[model samples]
Target: MRKKLFRATVLMVVPFFASLLIRLLYVTNKKVFHAPKSVGSEPIIFACWHGELLMLPYLYFQYRKTPNAKVLISSHFDGLLISKTIEYFGLETIAGSTNRNAAKVLIQGIRALKDGYDIGITPDGPKGPRHEVADGIVIMAKKTKAKIALFNVKPTKFWQLNSWDKFIIPKPFGTLHYYSTSEIDVSEMDIEEAKLLIKEGLLKHEA
Candidate 1:
């Protein structure tokens, strides 16, 4: 009985806390990425670091303003939580990984590109040696010939929770720095160079 009640309570409260956090963040920072006028109408593959996942929903929703945009997610429990939360924000998820069902997800991403919806990915996400970008985003961009946006976000203040990824949970009413750099040139990359380039970018950011 105790276990049953505990599970029930957690299910109820976890979502509440998630929603509360999202609302608080939405009200916090208003300045993030502004879609460029020329790039406004094209499909893009947006990449960001893993730690900033908590605040991504707020950013996504603000840009969407309507029902659009899709993200690639992993088939894991944490992905379950993020997928649910993303859906709650009216975004869609295509479940896959660099190792599992990757082709399917890439195809889905291509379809999204053709449909005029952009694909967003955490270059160091799902699981990570925190902030280490992976080659997956570049591979996807190369396949789809989609422009890449290196999404970046920083919080003025936040607690870095003790998780494998050191997830950042931004404080209520905090400031956030968000922007994206120009398209990552991935056309010449094979798997080897892609991996090296990804690590280089990660090191650049960490530096």
Candidate 2:
């Protein structure tokens, strides 16, 4: 009972504060998006490295405010906390991972896309060999014909965590640079080629 209470409290308080911090920092910083104007209107699969998730919510609110923008999060306790946090910023979450229950999540993603939702995924996530692209995003794009917008976020000043992905946190009031590649048509390439293409796009602006 005590453990449950602690978890509940953390879920509520941490997201609240984290959301506030993100918003505060966002307003004080500058960002640029290298995407087409039509990007805001189309349902796209937004791919970024797992470690670069800290500022994504801000990007969503500022630019990609698709009505049905949903993020793919793992079905784990940490994912729960992250979902709660991003929810405060007005994006929905779907809980699943490539490492577990992948088919179920892929089906969910397809359904969301059919309903005109833009999904966010960290292709190398839920446990990473750091920056390695996975096949899940490629498969989803192929199945749904959703354009994949591969992007990277670079903070001028930040701290890196010791975790596997070396998670990044931007300093309060630092500039963030955003870059994206042209929309990828997964149907034009096989999964292996698509993965390599996405990885190359992401690495172009890696910080």
Candidate 3:
């Protein structure tokens, strides 16, 4: 009974705060937050830390000039929330992660890139050494001939979640900051180079 009550309490609170974040932080003229650039006519893999997931849907709804997009998420229950939120904004999800059929899920993401869809991935995710970059994104971009765009979200009002990923939850009615580094054209760089650059860029953004 206690667990059921706890779960019920969580479900109600999570969505309420999520909606609060949208009301406070999802805004226009994101240009000041990120530099604009053409990501080539080919598809892109938008890589951001797990903490940035809160603003991701809004970023998609606001900045997507493309017709297709899908985010690669894990099979965890949180993935269900992420999936539902993205789909709620007319996006799709390709579920798979380091724990289950990771390769297949990655291939699906690459396929989405090939078929003309932008993809978002959290390099440090599904449980993480928070904010570290993983090589999987580099490998996938290299194989798919896609560019990578790195994003970071700085909250104006939020608490640091105790989850392994240090999931960030923003309180209602506060500004949020965003940083989008330049695209890394994987075709021009090796996997190691891509990973290094992406990692450096994200770290630099945090600093």
Residue 116 miss distance in model 2 (angstroms): 0.9
Superposition-based RMSD of candidate 2 using all C-alpha atoms, in angstroms: 1.6
Candidates in order, TM-scores: namely 0.79, 0.94, 0.82
Off by over 4 Å in 1: 1-13, 29-38, 61-63, 191-207
lDDT of each: 0.68, 0.83, 0.72
**Can you write out model 2's per-residue Cα lDDT over 56-97, one digit (the tens) per residue?**
865555455544688999889998988998988778988988
Candidate 2 ranges with C-alpha deviation above 4 Å: none
| lDDT digits (tens) for residues 86-203 of candidate 1 | 6767778888765467678767878887788888887766777666666677777777777776655677777888988778877766677655555666767786676566556544
Candidate 1, residue 41: the lDDT equals 45
Against the true structure, candidate 2 reaches a TM-score of 0.94
Model 3 deviation from native, Cα RMSD in Å: 3.5
Candidate 2, 178: how far from true, in Å?
A: 1.3
TM-score of 1: 0.79
Model 3 residue 64 CA deviation (Å) reads: 1.3
> Residue 166 of candidate 2: its Cα lDDT?
90
